[model samples]
Target: MINEVTRALVAHLHSRTPDLGSWVVVHSLSAADAAPAKDKLALCLLAVDEHDHLRNSPPVEVAGRLQRAPMQLRLSYLVTYFGPHDEAMARLTRVIAVFHTTPVLGQDELPLTLGEQVERVTVRLRNTTADERNQVWSVLGRPGRLALFYTVDVAPVRLLPGLDGDGRVLAHRIDLAGTP
Candidate 1:
């Protein structure tokens, strides 16, 4: 099932990227609370705001001057605006947020059984940047696969039903300073 999932994702990516463009594929396994759905697997894609159309907007400044009877002063004027690149960046960010938080269930290779029952699978965004995370949430609340550019990191995880079990969480929060 994992192999099939990987193939499906690769196919999907191939369809999205044009002949001149490209995308890299990645995979990982870590401790998780739930297994991937029968047909769908959790995925993450990272992207930068490189679209020129949406990111063209930059702060602008103009020269200004004030004059009094005996003194003259000059100051800079400030302007805030949005360009094509900015819009694209914002839209891409929103798309990523939705994909990370939304749970899609189907067929999967991972054997997921909780106690005696066949547990339902769900995908969740454990931790992420605020802006990127919120965008994923918004899209998750809606329907359909999100469209955007993103970098992906995959990890396998074991989900334990109880604290007494031996399954350990492989992913942990770390500070920017490198402290765990």
Candidate 2:
């Protein structure tokens, strides 16, 4: 199931941008009794579009931080879904990031059944071409229909820039309360 969703999303993104790269992520959702991060994730989509209001945008560059607020604004559309397969869900949910953008990764811990895991998946994408950045901004900023789906319950996954002292990639842990 995870692979299927990942493949579908990759395909969709690739279809839109042929020259993009992506990374797969798996999350745990046992601690979270319910999904709370969904709101934040959904809000991000909206932020992306609303933040800058799309002035003369530029193509995506391989090395650069995207205007974070705008991307976050664009992400706000995911709050309405509680399951996968919803139209909005398909467009908003991300288990992998394929484009070229610096990803902001973090997590919180949650209490749950003995060994159950509840998690949220987030993928950040940026345009690799100088022109694509502006084009992506335009696409994300505008109001239109997007695909989305209900997320699966699993371990929370985080994307970090490098590894930590523990020899693990420095990723945040998201729990029921929040990121910790």
Return the top candidate by lDDT: 1
Candidate 2 global TM-score: 0.17
- TM-scores for all predictions: 0.21, 0.17
Give per-residue CA lDDT, model 1, range 1-180, as digits (tens).
234333444444344434413332332212232332322223433232222332323322222322111111111111111224554355345334443543333334223322122222233333345565456545444222323333322221222333332333458997787667
Model number with the top TM-score: 1
Q: What would you estimate as the lDDT of candidate 1? A: 0.32
Query: Lowest summed lDDT over 10 consecutive residues: which window, candidate 1?
Result: 71-80
lDDT of 2 by residue, 1-180 (tens): 233323433444444445323322122222232432432222222222322343333322223532211121223222222234463354343423322231321123222221132233244433245454344336545322232222222232222333331132347987686676
Task: Give the least accurate 10-residue stretch of model 2, judged by summed lDDT.
Answer: 68-77
Q: After superposition, how far is residue 147 of candidate 2 from its true place, in Å?
A: 22
Q: What is residue 4's positional error in candidate 1, in angstroms?
A: 1.0
